[model samples]
Target: MYATIGIIVYVLLYTLINRKQINQHSRKKWIYFSLAICAGAAMLLLSDSSVGWLTKYLNNTIGDLTSVVISE
Candidate 1:
């Protein structure tokens, strides 16, 4: 709800601010913008799970490296 509204507002403001550039390179600009939006959405959806998994993996890897270094 709020997120959707925020996104809409951002797009509106962004378009207004970049109207000249957007018009000059409309097709390419819009395609890239859409791709960025898709990527952002993907990250937003996956951030929580990905962050937890990455943190755990890194902690284990670092712990193993530290133990090996200390032992040597």
Candidate 2:
């Protein structure tokens, strides 16, 4: 319901913003951003009661990535 509307609005807004350079290539980038936003929104919505858990998970993920980069 709301998610569907949100996706529709996002598509409309994205199309308007990239009305010029929105060919096949750049359009793929838009789809990626939209998917990221949708995933983030879904996570937040599903874990509204687990904010602390999500924060720690995200922090650990970032820390691990940084550690790997630093080690390499």
Candidate 3:
């Protein structure tokens, strides 16, 4: 309930704040990525289970990227 509302509010706030960045062709991808991050952060902060999930997601992603970069 609260998490859903918080996610919506945060998304709207992020969209407004980055509207100009989003319109820039080169920044479109980054803009969306930033919004996705904002949504993830908001969810993590709003929900107890979300924190554990987000932590695992971030750790795995970082670990994978590090391994790939180090292996190369």
Off by over 4 Å in 3: 1-4, 52-72
Backbone clashes in model 1, listed as residue pairs: none
Whole-model lDDT values for every prediction: 0.69, 0.68, 0.78
TM-score of every model? Answer: 0.39, 0.32, 0.43
Per-residue alpha-carbon lDDT of candidate 2 for residues 1-72, written as tens digits (9 for 90 to 100)? 466567667766776786566555646787767756774665455444656787789779997899999999
lDDT of 1 at 63: 79
Deviating ranges (above 4 Å) for candidate 1? 1-8, 22-47, 70-72
The true-versus-predicted C-alpha distance at residue 49 of model 2, in Å, is 27
lDDT of 3 by residue, 1-72 (tens): 687677878798878886886887686888788777777776556657855877789879998899899999
Q: What local lDDT does model 3 show for residue 12?
A: 88
Arrange candidates, best TM-score first.
3, 1, 2
Measured over all alpha carbons after superposition, the RMSD of each candidate to the real structure, in angstroms, is 4.6, 7.9, 8.1
Model 3 lDDT on a 0 to 1 scale: 0.78
